[model samples]
Target: MNSKSEALAAAKKRITDLQSQMTAKILAIAAEVEKLMDVTPEREVRDFLRVTCNLPSSELGTYMGFGRTLKGSEALLQKARVTFPVLKALVAADAETRQEIVERMDIGARIDTKEIAVVRKRLTEAKLTPEALMAQKNVRLVAAAARKRSADTAALFREKLASFALHLRKMNASDLALASLSETVRNDALELREQFTDIFGTSRRSLNKINLNSPAFRVAAANDALKRICEGRFGNSSHYAGVKKWPASDSQIIDVLLLLSGHPVPRRGWVRGRNAITELPPHRYRLKAIELCAGAGGMSIGLERAGFEHVALFEYNADAAATLRQNRPDWNVVEADITKVDFKPYRRMDIDLVAGGVPCQPYSSEGDQLGQEDERDLLLESSRVIAEVKPKMFIIENVEGLLHAKHGDHVAEFLRRVAKAGYQTEINRIRAEDYGVAQERHRILLIGIRRELAGSFRMPPRFPERRSNLGDALLDLMSENGWTGAREWARQRRDCPVFDRQGNLIAHGVLASTVVTRRGTPRTKEAARWGSKGINIGGLPAAAPTDAEASKPGYLPGLTARMRARLQNFPDDWKFHGGKQSVADQIGNAVPARLAQAVGLAAFAAIRGVSFDWEAMLWPGDRGRLQMTTPALYLDQPQLAPGRKKPEQNVRTVESAGDW
Candidate 1:
């Protein structure tokens, strides 16, 4: 044998022997820990190892976990450790599943971590056992959470105090569909301290004392304040629209309808541009944006319409990445797991906006409603990326239930964090109906402006007109396949008025139900049991077959994938690559492109310091009197407490329509 070959073999043997020895030593320590204390927690052993073995505390969990898994069984743990380093991941699987994985990997002479990792990933993805998912989920949650510091509560108090002080001063006569904000609710800035004390039982002075950092305190305060505003119980006075229902997290939407209530909505006709982003006047400057969680390019597409040039699009889904590539090959689409992708590289770029519609399940009303408690909640991650990118502005969209989650704890934490990070945030609870989408899907939008430009930034208010019906949204798509019933379905649904007065039919085809990601049809297992082969969904209505055999297959009407996608404001020209069910999932998960467009316009105006009379840019018929005839509760920079100095106004700032 050559000298080089002999040296290589010798080195490889050294590595193999050392790895085995280390695994054996770790197993021995773990077994000792287990035997010494019948109930010793892994953390206690971690500390013991830190002192006894000079092991770093950060790495103790791995050795302790290895011990907990196999005690002193060196051969077993040494093999599995290389294959699946995460002990919790292995333990989370059912015993049968774990045994199966071990048996499968036993084929190899040595533990091939790469090969085992692939099998582990496939098994985890296909099974998605809640136990296994949650184990990883918990670790991620801690890593993503904003580190708590002593200053967090102080920042929370200052933010709330400032918001309250400004709101009390701005609350005045405003006509709304539900109720009017009258003089009784409004307070003089100077008188607010005394009045606040007499009213909400806490003086403005004492609001700072309530320990805003306390989760319990923050939740209770938000609940009380929102409840009062929605129920017309603000300032210890009464004018609240008494909405009788369960204490929903977003009942505050009732107050939102009042706060920015605009001219009467045009109800009879269709809202134009329901399926497209409203094109605004061509602006000179094209601001740059970095899109996070850029699924299917919904937000990115909308931002493109809003005149923002995309510098990069970050998305994890391969299918979604393909969709973005298919549509805009020019866009720099980065397909990567967000947690691992380093944002430090883009810090040098002059990014003007950071926008994304993050996962909502963590705070969604439909799920466990875990809010900040859920590891899946990505708001903290978004904030982390935002800090890294340090954009001039950011727009984040989430489920309305976020405002009500954990008694409003999650949202308060979010706002406090934003304020502490030196950004001024404005939240708007928007109903998609008012924004040119057919569905009444309600979402909360949080727009943050860097503190320097905040004085000139104001939330764009709702346009009061209703848009086109569901019939209008999908009429073209349903007919694309030459389905004979398409016209009749749209005709019958459009003509007969349903529960909703205007803007997509609520029940019938007026407005298709919220085009969700999941189809309300049989699952694969259920279909198999029913002896059906390849079932179709969402294509013309299907009526029950008569004994006469008139109701043939495809005769009944259903909402098709294309039609649902249209209702979600995706242009017909853009195609979803996933076949049928996959298409449905994409459509359901997308942020209505049109809704995102409006949000982007708001950001555009905020960054450019312009009055977003952009509402007037909606479809000719749909833009109905785009005016706020009554006083709007939204306060401009001037109306805020005088103690705080306003940031320098930008040259682009407009002097008109300040009410918005």
Candidate 2:
């Protein structure tokens, strides 16, 4: 018993010592990073830490704040053994509050994140100094009238006015037909409109009159209506007698009004997730999907591997559509203008997902960044399809530029409409290299699921340890045409050290830069990046380096289409149907197959409310074969006799189990 107690005591002491050491190290790093900021650009310093030191950006600010707030207190902090999260709260607190927190720590009081949070909240609510706040013996409830109000009433009211205007635009004549108003209300609205017209100049048609569609008119009308309702100016008047008896067409408008009025409106069409089936339907091959802008079937290939069976693949470009059809003749490839496709017809088909890599030209930096003004922009059209088909979820892929402030209005409107369609949406940024693709391709994923499953979905876990470099990913393809220097070139690439923007080494091997559509001429910076990997970036090569090509004095091999495809994680067996330039464009525009598969698996798990053994399901095993397994509803159900059926069973036994 004494030996066991002594051992436990020693273990506890070691753990405590290690924790203090970690705290000391964290403070040391904070001081050094802060020192760097004095001599270096803030952004560059941040990037160096983020890439080279592997610090998450979310935690960067907290550590940086440590240098400012907790700078001369490293000894006290280490002695207190404060955790990082508690330090974060302290850093955010004011000097007086921080001093109080530190004093408590000095007395050997164990402070935690939640306790600090409560202390901060109490200080805020009481509007007292930290010492005064801590001196209280009993909890005292301050009267609302006596409490200081921190809200900006005018700014809040302006926000309410804007909300009123937006909500009014959502309503049509049918919504207002049964909404009676008193003479006072009508006169107030007219007065408001006159005031607005005076403030904002009238249109040319009528120099003194308000244009109905003008912003001034909408704001005036909405402001008048909202004010009257809030003041109860027409309470119990005949004007509002039939307001509750609105037509069925105004049901949505009613809900919108209830929300704007700060009234509780129960979520419509919300089915409890627990009640939904947790397994694939018995007769279905897999979840049915309709893909839009299916370029070269990259995402389609991934979804297929993730167990999705496409109902249709839509692509307007002829060569790309042809590639899909040629590669998988069994797929239903629809080569037509996606804008004109009638997705309403598929509403009854029970689609589980509507996934697409929407054209990114509208948001990409290489383009004009015209957003909705650009002819190729299909974001709203995608939203329309989601509304019509009402799939359980949807995934729209685009470049990160879509989230730029320049396109804020367009992105916000898209999210608003998607939310109105009974879906909860989130934007996620992911890197292809993090998912085992041999490139630094970053993509923005706009994912939406039915509101009931809002919190159920999570982004796929990253496997940075599984990341591959350019040489390892494409070595065989590089050596395909008997190039003698291929092995040496591959070795150089494999051994190259990758650096961050600040020139700090981040990794041991190089990753390919994002594949681009045009390879004809390389910019100076792009050329430099490729040159560092021992490759020529001028033009696409028709084939891998041959013996004759390698014999040239200064030849640096250019990547072939197959090599580029390999970098994009496309299978070697997959074939393209286009000429050289078109094939390059298709491959460059594709979502990396492995990255897409990871996302698809995450979406699948969320929608089905089932867990996945991600490694077995996604990672290819021996001989490049998938060791995929899916837990089915009828796995343990008794098999029926041949040619026999059971009417009572909800699950039907199949002759063979399906792969994930």
Candidate 3:
């Protein structure tokens, strides 16, 4: 027995030794690879290692296998060099060649698969000659190339192909239809064909007749023939054309649609002539953006959708930082306390915009009005960053309370500090509902443009009409298969009060007010009771109403998952990562996507001198009428004493008829 025990111990020791040795070898290999690339960013090094080792692209899988996979085989390295030739060039070539290669690769990566599939299916259904397939592929490739290099030559090719496709789709060969299309699509097509014939040594007729359906044709096609005639050539446009022309014994249309389904369509198309080229107009002032207190990228998503690129994102929470990294590995997310971090990095980047809503605790109605000293006075940290970055524009958002806090002194001081930083400021009380969001959340938006650019900057136009309602946004989401954890919550509050013309209590369908985090104590007694029972409304104990309202039919428990989603302005298809509570926290913390988009669009338009209609964005309920009090004013006001003077009391009453 003793001999056996000794043997077992020896085996265990050997296993430990082997693990250590393996670990050392991996570290050495990683060091060598890092040195070879001359790259120092930890994240970049880690990503390179993963790609080198063929590690799974997902965070969970990569973490699980990181240790074991760090030491990749030499054969795998060779494969990587071939597969990622551009990356290899980046490590070995001259600066100009490396830049050119990287740009080309980026363009290649951005080409959407859906677009190619759509064109293929469309051509197949059209029954064009076999030659048309090559044309289609050529056009697709050219469009992809144009997008990547932002070149006019590629644009000309794309325009021609799109115009031809449009003409085919219309199927109106009439003089009027032809004229209409000629002025638009036909012209583009002619331009493309002309360009193709000029670029390729072969005549357009010869190039157009090739059979695209045959593998031999793809392999034998000349590079210039394929490149010039089609948008992109995997070869043989003629074979592709033949495939389309071939009779569909089966349901070709249905089959084509099915095949083309779920393909992503390109946002831009080429137009005919040098004058017809469409490009994003230059901004009057270049705007650089930075996100502060970024939480899991919700705000960043909206910002990007609005066309503003983030230079840096600051978040103190570890999990949220991880979430941001998982979604956008390229983003610069600083995982340190906001106060402790230096803002100099942003200054160095020449940031143009500083944005974030500091935690609302000290500014909330239910919290102690600690104005300057609140532990959450991180708004000052944001201010400090703004001062350091000296961006051309600064946007600070928060609960409406920030405006009215300290009887407006706090707000005034905040504005003063911003102006002192050489920016001209404008403050507005914005309702999310006014911006096509179904939520009734109100926020204080403080926009500051650099004094130099203030003259050209304008707020985004409002929508011409409200595009959604609470029911519109939530009903579909409440369906059984919609969002998880939402159906039960919806059912539970089926009898809550809904505001309609009549006094009748219908179901709660409209969005509720913003969900505030109450600190230290519950907002109401009911909330305290519910919190004690672990069933507080709105998912936060401090924000819930008192228990006396427990069985009351009109009172709603915190927002349903669908309702929360609507408030956050997330599309029904976008999903949250966590459980109901975690999702709720995310929604409550997010800046409504629609609001962000509106702001972005408006800024872009203003900077570019473009006209955008703003009147349409107001909700039907709010049309032609402003709310009685601005959100900032409402949030800043203290609870009035029972006998305190009211604004109405100060108004002079009109004389009676007898006096007249």
Candidate 4:
């Protein structure tokens, strides 16, 4: 027994001595890395760490912080190791503050690793002094406030819906008899009209596919009234011929519209992510990124949810760019085409990733399928920027037809070029509904990692079990201002299963078709005329050619710009700037933010060499357990999701899922 005890004691001593030795060795290497500041510093140190110690560039700076703490006084650097984010922040703090933060983590708020990661990243970005850190509680106070305030979103939504009803009623009277409207409705409409004239200097008008007086000063106002009156009635003149039904006269239809408008508090669809990171502060990531073709900032928002810090977002569309710039003023938004921008400035930023949703008209089956022949085809330009930026990774999003475009050579050709630029690339066709989007949007996601880090990349997890229907996605958004017919509207919307042109069920109980750019959205003639600029690029056909709106090859009602953005996974607070059709087009063109989070998380995980638990992510146990993961797709039952593209493309060989 004495000999056994002696052996155990020796073993413990040896472990203790080795731990000290390991810490000392790491400290020594870190010191050497620092000392080489005058000589090819970043490259030499990054290479040594990557090749010898197996640390990627993204993590190299973190270890350097650890070494600095060990050399400094009483900072508890080793304890900080339990949470790397805390370690990261603690290292940045002064010695006394660092120790205080470590102790506070153990006692106060009892923050977990995930929260710590978020807090640390935010603190790092803020770069607060130790004194500021103490006063701010390192932003935990802000997180608590967000959680409390999010509850008020429902009340706010109600207020907005009430205001919406007043406007709709006023717009309804513009074309019909004010005396014909109910006394309560006419009074409310009058007040709203005054407010409208006060804001825009004009009275509202009525509009639809057959209307000629469209694109006036109040097209949104007119269409909104018509939409509220006509929506959920399920009578858009597209029913089967075999069914004999009673049709409402114009006056009777107007009465039903007014009655439905005044029904309940939830007047329009209301959506606040039942489980989503509605804002930042409590959940920010440590990595850096840049986005191209950032329409309405959809992917940018998603990447933010996944914990990335956007360095810049490049977009050429004036209105869509305005929305991004207005909402995220702090972000660096570069308004320019990919070819016009010089990427030399970003070459040394150590950006971890770059994302883009290049225009797909050239490759889409709807148009000429011209592929490389189209002048607007931006594949080469996208590749050039990638080469110049030379980030550790990149993700390119486009319509799924690109997977089968130019007999599939378009994607293959781009892959070869990116490979030549020193990247190991892989492509996958992902269905957006699988990731909780109400619309079944199938997109081709091309992920490219620097060849050296290729081994770390993992195939992004698929969410086939996700089943978000339109009713759940937009119910709360619609339930504003106490509209009485809202519940019934929801019931009918669910009954309205979305089918593709092939007469196949794609998604059930959803509120919108996929958000397409303005040209593809189902806008009434007036709204379309107001939004269309009628210009083509590189000799390609005009994106919005002169069209017959009343017979819009295929038309579906109940999809508004606001609802379209919701279906595209935009948060309620995020606003889209521009006219009705322009906004709709922007929403449609965007990659659903919910789906983008998956790609962002995948790219981030590759850098960190971590595997995600998809099941756990989809189903969480604690309130703060999840920050930005894919939202639950199914509220009650599983439903099939359908993908959408431009009109049937007159395809003799292939067909779209939806029919007009």
Candidate 5:
């Protein structure tokens, strides 16, 4: 224990020494910067202390090392006045002299130089006069008030400067730094313009006119400036290899610098181009696709993955249209309401597929469920376009609740309408989980095939098996130090159940019940099963659970990270973006990428009438040889009778009676 205490003391002393060294270095750098900008040392020190310590302007005088009011310390106050002209003027004038001048100025009474001298002489003779003292006090009070107002104004100006600095850093122009200057300082703007022009070799007017909003322009400027700075500072030598290794585009580097400096540029698009996969190999068949009620590019991304080249996309939201334009520069993202968009333009195009996920609110349980009455039922426009264009196939996806919708008759009527248009349709429920996503989402898919191709069309098979578990997906994401409950909810965890290494509850797994969202309202077992009274589980304290608490069963005691990951079907590499609520929402709304990939591959197979042998595609040279025990091909075989087995364990299973 004695040795441990000695070691701890030594460590603490080392830390204190390092901190002092860092402080000295920072102060030295600040002094050098002030000298370069021609700013006073005292003003520089004040600015440095305020920023480093995050001290407010009101507290500046109090924290100044000197044990005196800002005005009382004449020597220090004068130094400050160099950077604050108003403060200088106030400090230089005597209180009685100032009041007399103010009175004369206010009443428009001009005093001769001889009268001023007479008054000054009388005040000196009578060392203590009530009227004179009162006048002096009032002047001093006015000066203090003015000083306070100046401080407030200076603080606001500093905030603006900080914000601008942050913005410039984000733009990759970190060389520019703001100087603390009095309002009376001349040529500040000229100096800034000259410095910028000299560094970039571009005129101030031209630089100001460049559109930072355009990604192309921003990227170009960022790249050019970075190259210039690197070449000028490091020379054309291999020693500068480290500088060239930075992965961020010049614009991104600048943007980050600006943010750190205190200015944050407003992000414009979903993401930069470098982040997105913009190209893919073309499909075997020339699939001319059409988007119905497309809002931005959400559905478009899926359709493109499914081997469909969109010939036209219809959207009504103006902002969504702009977003589409920003991403897909050449796409025909028509900004017309689906109801008003005429189908005549597409009649002559060789349309192969019509794909869209119609809006769900009208059929949603939360809505009035006025299926046909809801104006959103204008899906008839999509059907009308399909009828006119006479596509070979069409697909419509919607929320699962649509299956049990009261407007079953309306769905039947719509089917009849599509039949009249000469197409056969099949409706099925698809669970996103079965497709390999972590989320247990169910969507209704309506597939319509032209009568001529009805016999050839077969629904894609379900995933052969579950590829991963919840634990497998999220194990990498758990904190290395282990979980810590949220600050507000930390106390609650004391009474909450805990999980063992294998994720089994120390207590029985059985609980009251799970919470669910129904008709947009959260329903919990706490209200129905436990009444308003709460139960204490294990050693934890009990509190009344709200509607939100009921819906979030995972937030309850003993819920493992793996369970949450399983529900979302997230890939091992996929990470949650927001806090717990955001993670939950994304998991709930996103389609599993694995499931999407499987569906995309299956759709491609159905369209081409071929199977995708993953092993064969990966290694074609081992076509005839058995490189590994695993088979090269996978198929959806029917279930067999109990106790039945294939002649070879690796061979495909034979279908039994009623297997279909």
Candidate 6:
């Protein structure tokens, strides 16, 4: 062999030897971690590896996971002499696929990470068998041939038209019934028809003759359009239908809805012009938003504080709408059913964000979990708004129960519908306490960004260390009514030990259980839970505990509406509008303002491609005015009070709506 060829072979050998060495070292480290886990606490070992050893968390997880996934297969891996990347990919693969890949390695087949990824995609998307993937004519080759044929300009037009025809034949009255059509559908069809008129130069007089709502007329129009296409014309044979420029509208609600019902959507012909990003109007605010189900203004206040100016806020609840207007007179509050609201006007207005805290009762554990069947469930309607408004990003906050297995299909369909609108989505769960709210409420946020900003968006960082307990959060309000025992009660609550679902110690002080919406007497089990936390849940209190109440034989303070609001992280100045029950519902159902702010800031950062000083933005001194006025309750270290000092005759106090 020539000198160059011989040198190249030598270098290849060196690479293979180095790769084998890396694989062996990775396995050895994984084995050592497994051994150390038996003698040392898992958290200590993990922290040491991260801080001292300086191993990246992602790499550490992969290495440690190897002990569990590839335990008995170490001998086989050594025999194959696989690289670390291939082994890591195998570790991430499903059991059946991983076994197949290992079998290939056992047979001396040379494989790489990219090939493994392709295999995984084929098995998932095309459901190809391991043997089929290994065949001479593999899935990739078949896909390549199909793509090549699809690339032909003439063939592509014919294929799309053929698919459109099939959809027309399947279209039924059920798909076009006016009673079944959403406002989004009607508005989309209207917009598209206008575009269609201008596209073929068909006279408005001719198009106006057709009744869009009538199923028979729609079917006839579809058949005529198909016929004109087959003859190489839109209105005439010489007129090419494929060459017209489509409208630049992003609203595709009608086509997406049709596609969901098994009809093929001709996105290219009708909405190709939508690819152009509409230039937004100059505004004073950093971002423009339209908020749905703007409950009692919790999320609205948070998002507004996070740098969004709402063009409009929609809320079906009369009391909630009143509360929003009562707080921010400048906000355009629309009291209407979201299902009937037409959001297409905002499409061209360049709305940067669309946010909603949709009703959670449909998926709450307290309810039937009817999901899509529940009339209150507006998950799909929210997605429709995302399609209509075509915002840069959207946030949908609901209960954690929305992610349960019972709602898997419903959640999947929701994601798929949003994807059709050119957005990527993810389900993220956040704890209220993690964002500085004292309640133990856990909520699920469905965040979606435009497809182009997929990886740019990320959930905000969590602050577990900053989580406050109920006593520290509500001490001021709890002691407002001359209750002599309030300080001792607060001390007991602050020092309470917390446990996990498994009854293991997890924390020192306890956070309140989710503040439920019911204003009526609590059930037996719920009262017992509150009793253990040194509080009364039997009924909502009219006011904070007084000396008379504390003097009773058995006294445990019940939470007032304002105290509940405090736990929810609502500012003391924010007022509620309604009767006691209605006020309770508003406070209980609303998102914690602090939690919403965290998520909103994260979305703002991603949409605008900017970063924030999290401390300055989230924990500003002005935002903590209410908490600042309250006595500081020790969080971690407990110390003895010098003595029970008498309450000051003229103790300074902050004005609060709770006094009502």
Q: Which wins on lDDT, candidate 4 or candidate 5?
A: 4
- Model 1, range 1-660, lDDT digits (tens) per residue? 999999999998898888777666656665665564566554444444443344565655555554445343456557644423434344444445555556654664444445446666667667767887887888777766644532464354445445543444444433331232444333322233333333335423333445332333433444345444534554432333453322232224323222222212221112232232333443335677888888876677678666687767777777887787786655667777778766765667657898998888887655688877787678877877787777888899888776662524345456667767778777767777777677657888878888767666655567655556665666676566555666765676566455545665444334444555654554555334222211234333323223233247544345555566667777666766756656666677788776787777778766764444455443334333332111111122211221243243222321122101
lDDT of model 1 at residue 447?
A: 84
What C-alpha lDDT values do all the predictions have? 0.57, 0.72, 0.50, 0.58, 0.46, 0.70
lDDT per residue for candidate 3 within 10-61, as digits (tens), equals: 9988976765565455445444654634544444444443433433343323
**Candidate of highest TM-score:** 6
Writing each residue's lDDT as its tens digit, candidate 4 over 1-660 gives 699999999999897677556545555555676675446445445545553344565667756666556455323333322344444555566665555456665454443455545655665647878788777784788888876775464344335435644444444433334333445544544554444344335544433332221234123433344333333322232322343322223333333333433433212212222332232222223577878888888888778656676667788889988898677655667777778777866776667898988887777655677777888788777888888888889999887666552334445456657878998776667877888777757788778988667677776677655777766676665555344444555566577676689999976565344445535433455344322211011111212222232134332224445666677877667777887667766876888876887787778678744444544433332324223322222222211121211121111111111100
Count of clashes, each model? 19, 0, 47, 40, 21, 1
Residues 255-286, candidate 5, lDDT per residue (tens digit)?
53344334545442322333221222223343
lDDT of 3: 0.50
Q: Which residue window of length 10 is worst by lDDT in model 3?
A: 626-635
Candidate 1 structure, TM-score to reference: 0.47
Candidate 2, residue 144: the lDDT equals 42
**Per-residue alpha-carbon lDDT of candidate 2 for residues 565-649, written as tens digits (9 for 90 to 100):** 8888888877999899999999989999878988988888787655556665556343232233222212222221122221332
Find the candidate with the highest lDDT and give its number: 2
**Preferred candidate (lDDT higher): 1 or 5:** 1
- TM-scores for all candidates: the values are 0.47, 0.55, 0.43, 0.45, 0.37, 0.56
Sorted by TM-score (best first), the order is: 6, 2, 1, 4, 3, 5
Which whole-number lDDT from 0 to 100 does residue 588 have in model 4?
69
Taking all chains together, the TM-score of candidate 2 against the true structure is 0.55
